[model samples]
Target: MSQADKLRQLLAQDKLHVMPCCFDALSAKLIEQAGFDLTFMSGFATSASRIGAPDLGLMSYGEVLDQARNIVEGTSIPLIADGDTGYGNAMNVKRTVAGFAKAGAACVMIEDQLAPKRCGHTPGKAVVSRDEAFDRIRAAVDAREEGADILIMARTDARHDHGLGEAIERAARFKELGADILFVEAPKTREEMIQICRELPGPKMANIVEGGETPELSHQELHNIGYAIAAYPLTLLAAAMKAMCDALAALKDDEPRTHLLSNFGELREKIGFETYYAASERYSTSRRY
Candidate 1:
């Protein structure tokens, strides 16, 4: 089966897809090795990792695609890309969606926030007009061929700008416009998270964080409230950042490589030399004379 079909089937079984947001090839490999069912190629993470900038819709289409392609090649898991604001109007969204779908994304989500938009959790967010955003979704849904399983996810950053009720209405309308998934982003409290969940059940979701603007809830807590999926956008990136910072700090005091062997095996094993050599040896042994 195609990757899209596999993802759809997994979601059909009401399985809670836990997609860790990955920024680069190494992180993607680490996640795949750790046995995640899916991946989220986060625009925020990509922009931050690649350019050291926040996710303010600053990167061009090519920049985003380059980073996404690297992650896609690094793993076989189904990925859902964050196609922020469709990069422009309906025509732009069409191209963006097709590009991401062709790049091995099972789904691509575009939000309603205005161009040069801040992150959902960030303050002073603005959204496009309801009619305009709806048309964007319609255009994207129309662009993809039928029965492709290239899911068109519609996200709204209006929860913080508008109110929960307005967010719910926009979500319902997006659903009416054939959006496969609805993301109501940046709920600040547990009560807000529960309220968002109670409002939109089944194939609708809320972005969860570890210590972000939203309440830090466990996967089970989110699933219990009828949330379809919980997109953890920064846990891995943040952890990696912390670990690297600490390692650098250790280097200032003494030889950082001195303890590298203590934590992981020697450099060669850590870099998978043994795995490659063993595979080579096995192939050599099994070769025909």
Candidate 2:
């Protein structure tokens, strides 16, 4: 099955999918090895990992597509990529969706945020007018109809600037425009989250950023609240960063930091070294003509 078909089947099942977002090829592989059915290439985490910068629209469309391609190549599971602000106007939205689809993304998220959009939970975030927002989704749907073979996830961040009602209304129209998924970013309370699900129809995604605006509900809780997917955008990144910092601190203290290390054999296996050597052994005496 196609990645998009796999994702659709997963969503069709009556359960909430727990998606741990990825920032790079290695991270994507780790998540897949850990048995996640799907993953998202978080712009915030990707920006930090790739460029050592914040996700305030600093990474261009080409850079984001390259990252998406790397992550998609590293795993067999479906990937949903963040296509921030579509990187330009309505036509640009189509191009971004097509690029992500060609890169093997199961879905590409296009938000209604203004040009040079910032992180959803960050300050200074603003969305464009209603017409422009709808136009973006329309273009994305058009791209999909034109053989992109990817899902369109329409996101709205107007809750922070306007209100929950505005965000819901925008997402509703996006759904009408043929968005396969709807993301109302940064809903601050459980009540608000519940209300969003109650109001919107079809598959919906909840972005759970650690220490951010949304409530950190359990998978069951989110499922009960009617979310199709619960995405933890920064959990892996945060955990990895903390471990590296601690390992470095122990190194400074002249300690081996064995507790901070994975078993060498397991690491080698996870990195495919063992598999590579085994495959090489079969060709050890072979000479190509």
Candidate 3:
């Protein structure tokens, strides 16, 4: 099945999908190895890993699309891309959605946050006006309708500035605008989360940013709260960072950090050396380049 079709099938199931977001091709491959049916290309993690920068709309459309293309090429599972603010106005939103679809994203998430938008849990985040917000999603839906062959996930960061009520209102309108999925970012409490789900329709996504505004609820708790997808955007990135730091600290103290790594064979396998060698065997001998 097509990636978008697969995403639709998964979302149709009445279950809470625990998705671990990925930064790069290797991370995406590892997520598939761990048996996840879906994932997201987290802008925050990709910005940190690729450019050593924060996700304050610093990465351009080309950069994010290139990263997403690499990830999608390396994995079979469907990936939802983070298309922050659609990178410009309504026309830009359409182009961003279509580009990501062509890049093999199962879905492209278009948010209503203003230009140079910061992370959802970060300070100083603001969304555009209501008409502009709806226009963004409308453009995205238009892109999909014009043969993009991808889902449009509408996101609203309005909870930070306006209130939970405003966030839900935007998400509801997004659903009406033909968003396949809805995300209302940074709801503060469980009660607020529950209320957001209670009011918003369609398959809703709950972002679980550890130590951020939203409470890190368990998958069952989120499922009970009516969340269709629970996205752990930074967990893998943060854990990888912690491991690197510990290994560096051990090296500074002249201690072996072997325990922090997978063994040589397993590492080679994870890196696809074995698979590469096996495939190379198809060639009986060396051929001229």
Candidate 4:
């Protein structure tokens, strides 16, 4: 089946499908090899990794699209990218939606945070006016061409700014505007989480356990709720950071991997650089033959 059909099938199932967010080709390849059916091109991950900047809407559409294209090329799994406030208002959303779709993103999520927005999980988030956000959603839905299963996910940062009830109401409205998926970003407590699931229904998604601020639940538990999609957006990146810190500390002490023989070969095997080089050499040799 096509990726679109595969995604739709996964959505139709009774439980939430997990989409781990990937920062680069290495992460994407790892997720693919681990048998994840879907992944997200995280704007926050890309911005922080590439430039050491926060996801304060500092990254441009061009920058995001470039990263997204690389991630898509790296894996065959369906990719839902962070389009980041559509890089502007409604018109900009149209362009961004179309451009990202063409760039091989199976889907792109545009949040309702205003331009120059902070990260969704960050404190002090301010959202756009309801009408303004709705207009952006409409433009995003309208922008995609035929034969493009490029889904548009309308994410609301209003859970923090406007309260859960208002966020649910806004999500219902976005559903009416034909958002393929709805992300009510960052509900803090388990009660808040359950309430959002109950209140908002219809092709829904939740950013699972972002930054450990919101209540963390098992995948099975989240799927038991009505959430059709769940993303662990930064877990891999966090683990990677932790490992890097430990490794560096070990280096500083002149004890880097000294006793850590477990999977030393597996570490290089996970990167698979030599395998890629071998494949490239075979192709080059074939051309000469």
Q: Pick the candidate with the highest TM-score.
A: 3
lDDT tens digits by residue: candidate 3, 203-243: 99999999999999999999999999999999999999999
- Model 1: per-residue Cα lDDT at residue 110: 83
Per-residue lDDT of candidate 1, residues 221-266 (tens digit): 7778767777888888888777777778788888655553334555
Residue 27 error for model 2, in Å? 0.7
* Deviation in Å, model 1, residue 155 alpha carbon: 0.4
Model 4 C-alpha lDDT per residue in residues 18-52, reported as the tens digit of each score: 88889887889899989988998777788888779
Candidate 1 lDDT trough over 10 residues, lowest sum: 258-267
* Candidate of highest lDDT: 2
Q: Which scores higher on TM-score, 1 or 4?
A: 4
Task: Score candidate 4 by TM-score against the native.
Answer: 0.90
Q: State each model's CA lDDT, in order.
A: 0.78, 0.94, 0.93, 0.81
lDDT (10s digit) by residue, model 2, range 70-125: 99988999999999889999999999999999999999999999988999989999
Model 1 lDDT, residue 11, Cα:
77
Winner by lDDT between candidate 4 and candidate 2? 2
Which residue pairs of candidate 4 clash? none
RMSD per model, one decimal: 3.2, 2.0, 1.7, 2.6
| Candidate 4, lDDT over the whole model | 0.81
Cα deviation in Å at residue 56, candidate 4?
0.9
Candidate scoring better on TM-score of 2 and 3: 3
Residue 260 CA error for candidate 4 (Å)?
A: 5.2
